[model samples]
Target: MRQRLAFALGYLRNPRHVGAIAPASRALAQAILAEVLRNDAQVLIEVGAGTGAITRALMPALDRLDRFLVIERDPGFARMLSAHFPELEVLNCCASSVDQLPLDASAPVTLVSSLPLLSMPKAEVQKCVSAMLSLMTHRPGSKLIQYTYAAPHLRPFANIPYGWRWRRVVSIWANLPPATVWSLEQTPRGASIVH
Candidate 1:
């Protein structure tokens, strides 16, 4: 109950960053967790984790992951998340700085993002998208799972990377305004390091 109120306040303060009035619904969180469980990843980084609604659901998979970094741009939300989940490595920073994190390149990474790409400023979006792509590209077998409020068929952003492809994972209508989950990954041929 308290979490809901804080999340609502967070949204009121910054509609674009918070994205939704309420935190991700139970169904939406479950859907994302299911996807995470299906894919075996060494490192799991969740970006735009507002108020940790999905973070609660992801706790179950904590045992399997070597590293779990929760990235929340909002300082208030980040502090709240850190307080709530002391076990997690919560970072208060923008999504565009993902590449700067001290991550192990040998470990496969799977980044779950809740950023509202379509509605954000284009320049910021491009920087974030490029950063995310670079992180995934450097770590072989890495993939990025992002959810958007856009149509189910839409790829999160256009420029499909060099060899990466987007696959629609699931469309969750139970959420506040509904959301579609999409994953960006290297095609089999693109899995190997080319540069």
Candidate 2:
């Protein structure tokens, strides 16, 4: 399809950023969507939404959302996302600036990320990870959904915040190279890594 072709071209341009040769599979998208709908989120923010694969899957959540934001570092992909999803606001910026966004402090947020964190530069990843954690800290009950191509047993972060934890949602064998989804959120007691 045209969408997949565009995604492939984007991947070819920057494999490190695009992170995959093909767009996320429907099964993977469904898995993510299922997690998104598990709880009501006031704000929906997606980072590194390459060619809007997960973005399209997130459309159903729009009806109940207060705001929907798509962050794509690549300008071309940002424009394509904007064009394909005119209903949402697509920002062309690094995920490191996530804390700079004008998000509500009281409203809970759900951040869906497709960024190649492990593949990106260490400094960039640190900045992004710190900012994301800060953003979630400011907005209580906020959760982050991130999928990775790493091993099944690996946690998103080896050491998370003291009160936050990462929960494995599902593993998508259907996807190219496969992927594992993890949700990071504040635990009632303290931080713990659960597989």
Best by TM-score: 2
Q: Count the backbone clashes (under 3 Å) in each candidate.
A: 0, 0
Question: Which candidate number has the best lDDT?
Answer: 2
On residues 79-170, what C-alpha lDDT tens digit does candidate 1 reach at each position?
Answer: 99999999999999999999889988667898999898876777988998899888888887899889888878877888766777787899
- Per residue, candidate 2 scores C-alpha lDDT tens digits across 4-37 of 8998888878877787778899999989999999
The 0-to-1 C-alpha lDDT of every candidate, in the order given, reads 0.87, 0.88
TM-score of 1: 0.93
Off by over 4 Å in 2: 189-195
What are the RMSD figures for all models against the true structure? 3.0, 1.7
lDDT of 1 at 141: 87
**Model 1 local distance difference test score:** 0.87
Sliding window of 10 residues with minimal summed lDDT for model 1: 186-195
Pairs clashing within candidate 1: none
